[model samples]
Target: MSDVDVIVIGSGPQGLAAATSLACEGLTVLVLEKADHLGGAVVSAEATLPGFVHDLYAMSMNLFVGSAFYEKHRVELQENGLEFVVSAHPYASAFPDGTSLKVSTDEGDTLKMWRAHSSADAEGWQRLGQLYDDFTQVYFPVYSSPLPSKSIASAFRGLWKVRATTPPAQLLQLVLSSTRSFGDRYFTTPEAKSLAAAWGMHLDFAPDIASGALFPLLELYGNMRSGMSIVKGGAGKLPAAMARMIEVRGGEVRVGAEVVQIQTDGRKATGVQLSNGEVIRAQRGILTTTPLPNLVNSLLSKQSVPSKMAEAARTYGFGPGTFMIHLALKGPIPWLDQELSDVCYVHLAPYVDDLARTYQQAVAGILPDEPLVVVGQPSVIDPSRVPNPNQHTAWLEVRAVPSEILGDAGGDLSEISWDEARDIFAERIIDKIERYAPGFREQILAQVAFSPVDLERVNPNLVGGDSVSGSHHQQQLFGFRPSWSLNRYATPVNGLFIAGAGTWPGAGVNCVSGPLAAERLLRDTHPSKRAFRRSR
Candidate 1:
């Protein structure tokens, strides 16, 4: 007998969203989390000190704010004591030359900031800003909704109409072109180009990568419209909010419960067998997120997943790893650029070439001598991030490692000590930060580090600290994410499905994959209620 209508494995953003949506539909839902809490990597916190909330992984919810998932669920989250906050001026990237580029919700103000760096770039910046605003207004809704490619097509048409006023080919060039090559199309100056390059590199792809140009505009929208906000107290607030929502809707989230295997009846998934030997039954088993290989070799038996499927999963690559440093400072970081004081996020790369080198080094299994570090003072934006004014926290996220580096490229994460590696990474970051911000080393009251190894140990889905869930390459995106030519969320197994960052709409705190999975589940159980198209 089924105890619940659906059992969702993993309580990350996608899993949480899936569970919440299904629960709201009056379906009995049960969420299982390996960790003792919710939010997966999205809302994790590691205490480097007594009162500092070091975001274990992601530092901000900027991407989530760009999604309608947060908007639709904002009232519910706030009622549960979760408040999403943002800064007035979202992000600022600085060069050693002291020149900088800033963005804000106000398009005109953003133009002024860009103008300070280059008047020519200022015009291009204004145009791009308006284009981003238009794109967000039109495409963001379809992105938030669980709509298919037809909806994307419709949104593309709307984008075309808006871009028609500009050069006819500009829209196509921006969307389809490489950020490294096409980035120059928007800006002429070096600093302006560097800013755009760094923005696209957020996913860890180099500027020359195809469709990388599209990310800069998306990043701009997310940062300017909504500054990265920390959940009050810690990053875990987001997951807590999801758990509260689920409980209020008559669902339950069981933490410290590791799902060992998916029980299948040859043609369909019946339920899950926990690591501790508890067997829970459900009408539909929804695995909200997981890498393809683990889902095959670890969760399902050989018969359930064919050899061809396993082979395809084997060929799929996990993305780059992030070397993170969390600092509990004795005092606030004193920046040479006073304007940087209020900044929540900082990308410390002098040139586009530097950003490229960082990624190149990572692919080669080496960290750059000079890494691309994203530094943030969470306490400045959220008072509760620190225990007192005397105490402050800074998160330094660097891109320069691979998930498979720590162990035998194929062994499980148990083969390494991620915690120790994290300490080494923290030292390098403090040294780098001291370069621009003098006496920065003196302000350190406490410090903690997370290597790619540490990230994987903390969350198995992270897979060697590759935070974007899986590689965001073209073949791995859309319905092909986690694998090409497969409807990821809806697996071949009848009652089994996939979710999490490894699914479509690919990683980040964005809940598209989760909510989309829920919509698919709803459609699967009640096909006539909602319609969805399969990949063509």
Candidate 2:
């Protein structure tokens, strides 16, 4: 008998979700994590100062809350010490001129905010809201289902059911439109346009990139409908709860277990060899949640997979880098528009033109003069993150930074290394925020910044700090993700599967890939299903 039914490599959300599913289904599972801590990007720490908790990466639980995994295991996870706090004000945007716009769960409040900017844009927002209601009926099902599967086919059939309500042309446009095009088509005012377009940057989608409109639409409207959620204490709590759940179900999660090689016999994966030289065996299969590069290049032998599949994995593109600044604050961010304090996230990219410029500059290896800043105010939503009620924390995300410092667009830090320029760039980001929120710098009790290089050091899955793991560009999305050959979450190596932010429905707190991958493995390994297939 093998050591375990399945050996999950990586303790990220995806891996944990898969292991949890398998464990609950009566399969023995062992999760191996290289790092001492679980929750790859979903970790929390007192990074800046003692007693001030900050989410290291991926603070938003909105997507995870809406996920199928959560739908199935919400009660068990909650019972296992998982608690979520919802924010009524999901997101907002702060402009250079001290004006800001916010999206609220209340439709009337959101409409009033839009109308204050432009009546025509308000009407456009209303129409978009209607479209969102109709489009999600088709989109969500397809998004949650596996690409090129019977479930996805069933999801497509939903399109036919909703065609009378939502025209096929509109859906096509949503799939193909750029953020700039989508914004221009929907809203006339710069404020309204920027509010939606800035979200594109969160997914490495520049304003002008084709097929970039979908994410912005989804984020803007999705938050408006369901608000936002954060783990009760910190992001780390969710993964800890998952680990506990797995343990209670008789599965094991081992940290500091670095899987250096996947030991295979013929074309079948047998187990993994740790860096320490210990080999752990899996009876049924192995699931890897590591990035695609590590999966194909570092873990597996070149001869194990087809040449084309290996090349595709080798050439899998990671998008622009992300810079993070975690600030321990004496008090709340002193926003010029105080309304921003109540919201979960405040985007600091002022205009669509600025977003396009920053994205282009980063892609071309230049530091942006004005990078898009995503200001996350977790304390406002949940005060337990701080030591005292008067204290606060600010999670600042600076997007579209170059992985390698080639040149600074501002021309100052061109010669300096990221190690040398991290603080300087962080100050530039703080200054940008200060322009919108005066005295913002004064509230900072302590600050810790991570450059693109630092993020990669923290989580190799981040590659060059492309936090979304890999780009979600049209060619790399849907069934074409990672590659056309391995998009179904299975490897050319039988019984070895891959799933992560690098795979389908890429990125975010959306925990779709894990459970979907587990379902596939279960179906493939089921005795009844196998017998039926052989009979056919």
Candidate maximizing TM-score:
2
Structural similarity to truth (TM-score) of each candidate:
0.91, 0.97
Residues 1-536, candidate 2: write the lDDT tens digits: 23899999989999999999899899999999999899999999989888999999899999999998999889988888899999999999988788899989998999999888899999899889877877788788778877877766765776787788778778888889999999999999998899889999999899989999999888889998899899988999999999998999899999998999998898589998999889889878999998778788889877786787788877799999999999999998889998888989999898999999999999999999989999999999899999999899999999889998889998778956899999999999999989988898999999999998998888889998899999999989999887888888887787888888988989987888988889888877777875686799
How well does candidate 2 score on lDDT at residue 352? Answer: 93
List the global CA lDDT of all models.
Answer: 0.74, 0.89
Query: What does candidate 2 score on TM?
Result: 0.97
- Among the numbered candidates, top lDDT falls to 2
Q: lDDT by residue for model 1 over 1-536, one digit each (tens)?
A: 24788999888888888899899888889998888767788664656777677877876776676566788988888889777667776677877866567666676677777777788988877677667766665556555544345767777677676765544366666667766775688789877788778876668567777877777788766667665666667778888888889998889999998999988888678888899898988865565477777788788888888665677678767778888777888887878787887787777876888887777766766556666788877788777777787778888888756554433221223334545445555666677778778889999887777788777777888876888867777766665666654463677777777777776677678878888888777777564332342322
Off by over 4 Å in 1: 44-46, 145-148, 404-421, 527-536
Candidate 1 accuracy as TM-score: 0.91
Q: For candidate 2, what is the lDDT?
A: 0.89
True lDDT of residue 122, candidate 2: 91
Which ten-residue region of model 2 has the weakest summed lDDT? 150-159
